[model samples]
Target: MSHVSVSADQAGQRVDNFLLARFRGLPRSRVYRLLRRGEVRVNGGRIGPEHRLQAGDRVRLPPVDLPPPRPPQQAPTRQLDELGACILYEDERLLVLDKPAGLACHGGSGIRYGAIEALRQLRPNQPFLELVHRLDRDTSGCLLIAKRRSTLRALHEQLRTGAVKKRYLALLTGQFAGRRQRVDAPLARYERGGERLVRVDAAGKPAATVFHARERYPQATLVEAELLSGRTHQIRVHAAHLGCPLAGDAKYGDPQAEARLGDIGLRRLFLHAAELEIAPLDGVGARHFSAPLPSALESVLIRLRQQTLTPSPP
Candidate 1:
């Protein structure tokens, strides 16, 4: 049996809880099995799973035999160029990668080799890097990744509890008369060309989004969006319902406007995950992550600004 002495900081937490906290990869069932077999002892005595640990308590642990590591998978030919890659923040538990436009978070449908798979190849030793949340393939900005299972669980719990804050920057194709507006619409799935799509339906699950116009251009408006409920394409569907579909949103916007926007470098949907705020577990502190507007979106903004300066004929 291996012995472990509890430190001051680890005191007050339960033995099973503390063991689970320290050894992230170990399953809870295994930990409890060790406790029941007297393989785990506290202060030279076998204790129950509910034993509260105290500072200076010496615990004995059984030798846990782990499986042999498997051979690493060969990565694809495409090497991630770090020069253009934006890293917003990183800690022992998490990494916030500023995902570029046109990169999928995970492989699906007919696409392969996504951001997470590429990152795995980039950092082979970190086999546990996992996506805490996802952004659409065309969306760009702050995307959180967890480095450990425990951290992933913690972050996911925070997301479920509505403790994490998410904000997006979008350009809509029409002038919004109101400065701030809230859309409380329910969304239901609809079928289009054999593909599933979400639409605002009164009988569907409730979804809400808050929009505030930041700047008004001659033909477009810059808006900040805050999502109260996370649903697939919530912001895009809601904005479309408000008669101001996002710029370059081909699937849900006016076809003529989409074609016009396409001529000006607004190729894909103009939605981005701009900022995220999450409270850290273990009482570390609150953390915030933000990514600058991607070059594609920034270029569109520049063109829009130039258009605003040109005088319109009465």
Candidate 2:
């Protein structure tokens, strides 16, 4: 049996919510199942799923042994340096990496392993490296990895309390109206067969993004985006909603315009998580980290700059 105690800060939260927050790898459905089975109790009394927890509540959790660990697969034969892994910053608690385009943040679907696995192999003793958050496979730039579970929990708390700031660099297909704009819209997920996508819907969770145009050209605009809420595909959907879909975003861009850009080097989505700022867990000042533009994206920008010098039709 596991004895769990609630703190004053965790008061008023549902029992299931508290369990979910405490256990990282456990699924929410399983948490409810344990509650339903009366495997969980509070202060020597069995509580229902709707029980509202109060400060100093002692929670009794049934002993739950985690499943056996899976055998580690053989490391891939690819050259580690060729993977383009670059370290932006590193400390005892965390490592900020510049994730390259075309690599998944973590394995899913048919892919077996990802950068996290490779990094683990590179530093086997430091087995606690874990992704704090995720970035899309095609999106390149600053990704955070926590060195220990305690640091991960602290970083997650900061994210929940709005103490962390994230910014992205995007190349859009058209010129935006002003230097800066904010998009406040809700996002909902839609399933099409086996595929899932997010769209702006009134009934969905509240999402907000702020965009600032750094440079404007006839064909594309370089914009910086700051996320106010961390929803799936929030920035992509919000930018697409403004009719300035990102260049090479096949999922949401204009097919005709994409075809026209076949001659250019705009082959993949031109979005990168360029910067991240996190308040220090020790109550020190804020810490900021940034990843330089990957060569692929930088080459595209160079071409765009040359295009700007060319004369356009009246």
Error of 1 at 127 (Å): 3.0
Q: What count of clashes does model 2 give? A: 0
Per-residue lDDT of 1-314 in model 2, one digit per residue for the tens? 88878887567667886787666447677888899888999998988877878889999988775546556654465635644358788889888888888878776466667778777876779957888888888888888898976677678778778888999999877657788889999999998777888999999999999999887778678899999989988888999999988888877787776765556777788899999999976556789999888788888877777888853322
Give the alpha-carbon lDDT of every model: 0.81, 0.81
Residue-level lDDT for 262 in candidate 1: 77
Question: Could you tell me how far off, in angstroms, the CA of residue 249 lies in candidate 1 after the best superposition?
Answer: 1.2
TM-score of each: 0.73, 0.80
Model 1 C-alpha RMSD vs. true structure (Å) is 8.7
- Give candidate 2 regions above 4 Å deviation: 1-70, 74-79, 82-85, 310-314
Clashes of each: 0, 0
Best by TM-score: 2
